[model samples]
Target chain A: MLELQGIAVSPGVAIGKVLILDREGYRITRSQIDSADRHNELDRLRTAIAEASKRLEQHRRDSTEKIGVDIGAIFSAHQQLLLDTTLHREWERLISDSCYSAEFAVSTVLSRYAHAFRNMGSDVMAERAGDIRDVERTLLEALGGAPLQVSGGLGQSILLSHDLTPAETAGLDRSKIIGFCTEAGGPGGHTAIVARGMELPAVVGLGSFLHRIARETTVILDGFSGRVVLQPDEAALKDYRQRMEVRAGRVKQLTEIRDLPAVTQDGTRVTLLANIEFPGEIAASLQRGAEGIGLYRTEFLYLGADTEPSEEEQTTAYREVLSQVDGLSVIMRTLDLGADKVGKFTLLEPESNPSLGLRSIRLSLRQPRMLRTQLRAMVRAACGGKLKIMFPMISTLHELRTARMLLRQVIDELAEEGHQPPQKIQVGMMVEVPAAVLMLERFVREVDFISIGTNDLIQYTMAADRSNEYVADLYAGHDPAVLRLLQTSVDVAQAAGVEISVCGEMSSNPITSLLLVGLGVRILSASPASLPQMKQALRQVRLEDCTQIAKRVFDFDTAREVDAYLKTRFAELLPEMALGV
Target chain B: MGIHMRPADLLSRTAGRFECQVLIENNGQSIDCKSIMSILTLGARQGTQLNLRVTGPDAQQALDALCELFEQGFDESDSEVATEQTS
Candidate 1:
């Protein structure tokens, strides 16, 4: 039995045979191919790539909306490269000129392209190699002329590999692919997105997983926590079965609550919105009945792109988002880039501490062009939509004033340029830095609304790095300090009579959400996937109950104590709520 | 020398390389360089360490980075956990 641990990109549990997508990488058999076989083999390779392309398109059609069109388009690109006459011609010439076999020439050309693609000095470019490698593999498979099946019969085992490409993933049969584990990928990667969309349990980024896990072994896949148990004991199997049934039931229940309004038993109605980083997630949020988009992270536009998007490019993206929400309010935060968000070439110098350095509003003020371009795009897109501009990492009143000044300046610029100004859209601040919380009253006066960015707020407030797993257990959202700030911020927002919402990782966390509600945050926004569950939990507890429980939770000394106390109180308070409660 | 790690173990051996007893993010196989914010995103606070032995093409460099982040010499003050929740 082989056991390995890795990040849990998607959540689920399954027991299925493995499907390894091992690229017999590119190989040269040290044999000279006759001139006759070279053309024939090249033709076969072309055919295989073409066939793979068609299958990818079909997979796109069959795939539910969760798996993005990008995945399909990636396959489509691989198809083009495989069938590219230039690449094929190069291979042909290399074979004849170098006196090498078809396999040798193909391998040489493929490796050269792969290496060049990987050395592009960007993560996005490096990732493109994954798709290119798959194309090379497909061509190789065609030379064998045996129908390669990634997934087949029930007893037939996994197609385990170092990694699975978009093409390889599209080719796998749903029924036979009980679960897939990879030695590479992350929660944010395309594979996890595909797995979530396909309702498949996947444990990815487990290095050398194929070398460890045997073929055809009845392995238990725990996608919930990204665990693969091989040849499990009876007790383990039973536990997994029960867990599976519960998950299926939970999903069915959550789906049922899709269109249901998030109302409390006591008749208090609250808006549950989605905090989205991309335009693609908008549909999923609407499907889950999110009242609006509370947080449309604009940072993504600046990140991973070849260059800072032009004002036109930013406008196009912003307009697409505003148009899609369909009358729902989209509270868009301006570009919150810093040392972490800058493109590789743009990084001037590495800082000893980036989070503490000039970032967010600070960085934006430093690089006014990037910020202005985004603001112009946002303001332009705000026409005929309930859009608001939010500033992230606002610490002092001067920062807020400067941001507001820029907004007014932009509005005047639009008026001068003969452009009809968009809505006098609401302005907001992300209460992340502790100074922002301390000057809550001042900010309340300056901005239209508030959304507590708890992730940064917690890290900066606790003076602990949230990314350092070593100290992960130390950074507490429920700490007296965090609660003290939250309590004051929420109270200040209420006193000021501006609407307050929370859109952060903690907002999605059930315990934190409860405390937030108790602290007087009426609008709870998080990932749409967590909305139904949040709604169900919200329905079980009253504002008064939540407030009281939150008070108790904060008073606890350690996170362990707080977690334990909350769980016990939650069960006692909301018995028969959801099995989870 | 290659340090073993689960690709998904965000706060495992390599994850501990950041901030030692303090806190930091696990970038690729270890702490994210260029920006502490990237490490902050990892949300690692549980006191996880540089388990992989320091030796490789960039071993000394990696160790130097670790030492700098952890504030080498571990003065009780440097390694001190803020016992009280500061508001």
Candidate 2:
């Protein structure tokens, strides 16, 4: 058996036959067209364009219904590119003037644009090249070209491809396809993101060796460990089959308890919510039995667009999310764009140190109109269902008070416009900055609730940029200083009788969940996929046991000692809950 | 009409309903106006005069619309609102 290792993007296992989908060498050959047949060629090109546009429109509708509007927006952009007059005119001109075939002309023009985007040295621009190529392939296939055979009646197959665009992944037949592995794409690529949303077992960035595997080969794909074994022996296959059965049994056990509340054995109740970026994720969150949406990132509406979204547009989106949750509280964080996520409309000048530069609350306060527009939309949406507004990255009390003032102004204006104010509206702050942690008591009194954004809080506390691979070792969430800060904030919130929730990657981890429970944090929000596993872990430990664990953990000098102690304790008390550190 | 264009102006205007190639030439450098990256590379600030060239079946119509857009100063009214807010 040949073994390949890649980046594990989603967690699951699938043993199935392989379906190789190689679309690398579909190049257009330049051929001459007679002058008499030039009109026919243009007609073919127009028909092909019309067919491609129809297909893209259908894909956009399907993706919007299946995925979310943000993912569907990718297809919307593709449709816009297909309808671009410049691209259409360029290809038409090339076909008429150069006496080249329609396929050749289309391919040539698209390649030039794609190459230009590729050489631009920006990740956003580079991704556009993939979109251009996707459109080109669709048009070429419509021109009676080589069939880009990706779909068919395949039973229980793992799809292997060179790479997959977001549109392609969204359009896959999920019932027949068990898992997917790509020769390209990192953990952060759109393919991986969509795979996680679909809950499909996936591994990516395996390099070109994956193309060498023959079709219909029995392969074992372990997406959690990022291992793909081709032509597994009998013993290995049997072993994997047993492991799959175990996982299926575990999943069934978790689903049985999904409807039950996440309460400790000692009668202490804990709230488990889901962190979502798109409205499409509400179904999955509900299926996982999330009590509410802890963090709904609103920056997605502003990203990848040339113009700012209007208040009406933002209202429709927020209303859709609120309606989907069906009265479950949705804490919407307004437009956290900057640092690694600068959008087209929220462009800023290049900074040498963007992590410490103007971002989050700073950017929102600088553009008060933008902030006001979003707040108006949220207020309008709140009239329909439960909605809580939260300000992110508030380093000081001044920023919190200013943001609250703007929110109040929006509410008063909406009330004056004949719209009834929301009956129960809560405004909160994300306690991520170190300064915010120090003044948690004062901040808690002013806001309705507080959510600990541990990802940024840990990074800022350690003085390390987590995105920088060089200092990644320094950015540990288990650090004693970070835990102490978390404990302090939770203590302050509890004393003030305010609700506090931990919504970050730290709360998603099973071991860390125990420590957080011990620290007086009764609410934990994680990704929807991890909610079941987290609930299972929480149900296995009592609050008193967790408190004792936390006390011992706090006495440790370093993060390493705390992690080691927790790992050993969890393994002994709950072997099934042992997630390797 | 010769007109200067900013990055945002090019990004917003080039996606208009005209199936034609709009090329902008300045100081012997030329690139497609439809590409935001190309326009950004030009670094054309306010009042940097650019020569416009249209080539396609709808060249005349595209050129006319583009000239009208330029004559209106690439929709300066929106920028004026933003500037007013900041001031």
Candidate 3:
């Protein structure tokens, strides 16, 4: 048995025969063509372009119906390139002037443009290079080269490829393909997003391991652990089969407890909320038994589109979310656009260090008019629902006070405009920066509630960027320093009689959810998919036991030590939930 | 993220109907106006000034239609309004 480890982008398991999809480069020999055959060569190029255009349109229509219009538009872009009159003229020019064969002319012209796009220096424009190569591949296939057979041969197989584009990933035959693993892909790539959207088990960034495995080799892909085992022995196969059965059993077990409260064994009721981006996620959040949305990220309002969303448009979206949550608390965070997500809508000078630079609440304060428009929509949306406002990356009392002052202005403006604003709207701020944790007592006195954004808090505390694999090891949530910071925020918020919760990646895991409850966090928010297992984990443990675990973990100096202690205690205490974690 | 319109939307099919020889120039680089690849290669981001040159029997009509499209942000403004209408 050969075992390989990679980053898990989606969660599931599959054991099936391997179908290797080698996207090998096509070889185009520059053979000479006769001058008398120029007309025939031009006709051949035109026929190939027409065929490729037809196929691209079909893919566009198929993807538009399957995946949304945004992804479908990719094929439309490909179609546009296929039908480019200039491109055809360039191909004809190369064939007739240089006496080149039809395949040679097409490849030479398309590859030149593709190389130009690759050297364009902008990352966005560089991606167009891939689109150019995709068009070239289609035209070459129509010219009777190697064709990519997408369907008709596979049966319950796992796809192994060098890499897959978003278009190719979306076009996979779902009925026959069980899962997929790639030697090249990142967690946040569009292809990975498509994999997650299709709910496929996938492991990416495995480097190079495709050469050793052969077709029809029985392999096991574990998405949770990011392990792919090829040609497993009898014992290994039996073990994986048993684990799959356990996974199925766990899903059934979670469904039975979906309606149950996430209360500890000692009757400590913990509020389990979901972190959501769009209004459409509320139904799924409710289905997973989330008490409410703890973190309603509003960055999507300004991320993708060309222009800033108007007050009326923002009001409509906010109202839809408030109504969908059905009286549950919906805390709308103002635009947290900066850093990597600083799209075209929010205009800001490119800073050298965007993380510590103008971001989140800093950007909102710098552009208060933008904040006021959002605040106005939020105030208008708060007709009678339990709507709250939360500011992200709050580092000082002055920033929080200034933001609250803006909210007051919005409410007053609404009242003056003959709109009935809510009489008592709660306000909160994220205690993400280490400075906020240090002065938590002073900040808590001004806000109604505070939530610990562990993702940023850990990054700021560790001075490490988690996305940078070089420093990812340094960015740990279980570090003693991070625990002390969370301890400080929870203690200060409790003393000030303000609600304290954790709404970050750390709260998404069952093991960390228990640790937060032990550290005196009454509310916990994570992605909707993690709610059921977290509820199961919390239900299996006592408050006093969790408190003891936290007390012991705080004495450790290193994150590794804390992690080791927690893993042991988790297995000892929550044996029913031990297998998956 | 530049030129927010998708390639198909940016290179409107109306450009092909005209008999004019149209060219779009940016940063001293001119490309054929009827090609989506050319427009994408231009990399004309927001607030960029692109010179459109047209010459033929239908040059006037082509220039007017193309100018209006560029002024309207290549029909990208319509996406936001379309979403609001559906909602």
Candidate 4:
């Protein structure tokens, strides 16, 4: 029995036969079309396309019922690509000209398309090829019998894959699969998102186990810690058993707090909002008691579309969300595309450091017509809804002013078109850029409110890429620069008589939220999954000497110092751990 | 006929590769189903078909949307999305 310890990202346990998802590179090599018969090969390719389309349509049917129309559109778009004439023509040309096998042609083209993207280019364009390849490979796998067959009736097996691609993970039967452990993948990988969505227990980047842990080795996965123990000893068994009991108790406690208001023990009213990427998560957010959507990312609208969404389509999306979460404030950030959302979409330019490029309001201002169109759509949708507009990555008052000018232009257009627009739409900026936080005093006067986007702020502050496993040690959320920024943003906002809050990961962290509220943040936005715990944590403490603590933290240099401080403070404040008990 | 070019261009034009007559109306709205800028903003991609049931003002644009798919092959650019779209 082998025992291994790694980071457990998702939480769950499964003991079953290991079904390894194969690497696309090797599979492509094996399935290279080798026949000299051209006509027969064409026929084979066509049949495969038909099968892929049929399966995609079926997936659309199944998921549409579960997720809804937008997700359905994603599958439908894949099906449409299957009938793409250019793709077929390319395949024919490759077969005729290069004389390579069919599978080889697909593998080559898709791989070329997939790798064509520079991780630091225009996010929309950078992602275009991958999205295209994703579509291509989905079709190719159907043709080659590579992906679909891998999923056939393994019956609730714990997926052991060399590396599970996004498509394979999405294709997984979440009901049967208790968890997944992969040799390759990271947090930002699509596999991670799919697993998170499916709520499956997953631990990734576990080097070579297909040979070491033979089939059905009865492995256990700890998603919370990224730990995998094979054939545990008596002590390990007792530890996990006791851990399970604690988890169950925590679950019960959290569930009870889900329906409770996220208020501090001192009766200070703080609004809990959901920061989400898709409209699909809204239902879960509302179900979990989110006052409304703090950050409604517009990327998904662009991400899954075979084409850009029409103004009408954009309107429909905005309206649907507003109507569903009626009476709650919906803060909309326009096109927060930059270093992370790399793709080629024609309007955005490719940049070296996209993190500091013409993103957010900068991109929108460059494409005034596009920005105006989105704003018009959003404004038109806000006939009587509680909607506010937010500009991300704003570094100066000039950017904020320009973004608002465009907002006014959109409003004027709507008014000129005789549409009854909202009486007022509050303007806000995400204090995501360190420069923005530094300029909060000046910015607070210009915007009605502020949201601390801790993700980028931390990255920019520490100059660390949270996605890099090697540098993750430096990407601590509690680092002094990050905490100082949070504290300053809150203080600046309060002094300006403007509302300030953090809608970042720190806000969702049950422990960090203590520090956040301690710094005067009244609006906390985080993923809905973290809401219950945040609520439970908030109920544990009243206002204390946050000024002194913030001062101490700001003076500290490392995350370890901040973490140690928090641990000691938390242990002191809640000795029983009763809130999350 | 569609010209085969790099799709990674943020401004690849698509004016000729679509069905000029078949306008698939996007339910009660005026939309150019084919403009590259239109496609980009709408977030269209390789497999996203432009069914041009669009008529009236932007009918020709609808055809452009379909043909754009044929004209531009995929290219990589750098612009990471900070957040995904939520409903």
Model 1 C-alpha lDDT per residue in residues A52-165, reported as the tens digit of each score: 657655654555255765455455445545545456678778655654455455655776666765665555445555656776676665554223463223453433455555
- Candidate with top DockQ is 3
**TM-scores, chain B, all models:** 0.30, 0.66, 0.71, 0.28
- Can you give the lDDT of residue B50 in candidate 2? 68
Runs in model 4 with CA error above 4 Å?
A1-4, A8-145, A148-213, A216-219, A229-249, A343-352, A545-548, A575-581, B1-87
Query: What TM-score would candidate 3 get against the native?
Result: 0.65
* lDDT of candidate 2 over B1-60, digit per residue (tens): 122123233443543556776677777797776754355446454556667777777777
Off by over 4 Å in 3: A1-3, A14-205, A208-221, A229-245, A304-306, A344-351, B1-87
Model 1 bad stretches (over 4 Å)? A2-10, A14-226, A230-242, A339-345, A575-581, B1-87
For model 3, state the Cα shift of residue B30 in Å: 28
TM-score of chain A of each: 0.68, 0.71, 0.72, 0.73
Residue A173 of model 1 has an lDDT of: 64
lDDT (C-alpha) at residue A39 in model 3: 85
Ten contiguous residues with the weakest lDDT in model 3 chain A: A23-32
RMSD of 4: 16.4
Model 4 quality (TM-score): 0.65
> Which of 2 and 4 is ahead in DockQ?
2
Interface RMSD of each: 16.6, 8.8, 2.4, 10.2
Ordered by lDDT, highest first, the candidates read: 3, 2, 4, 1
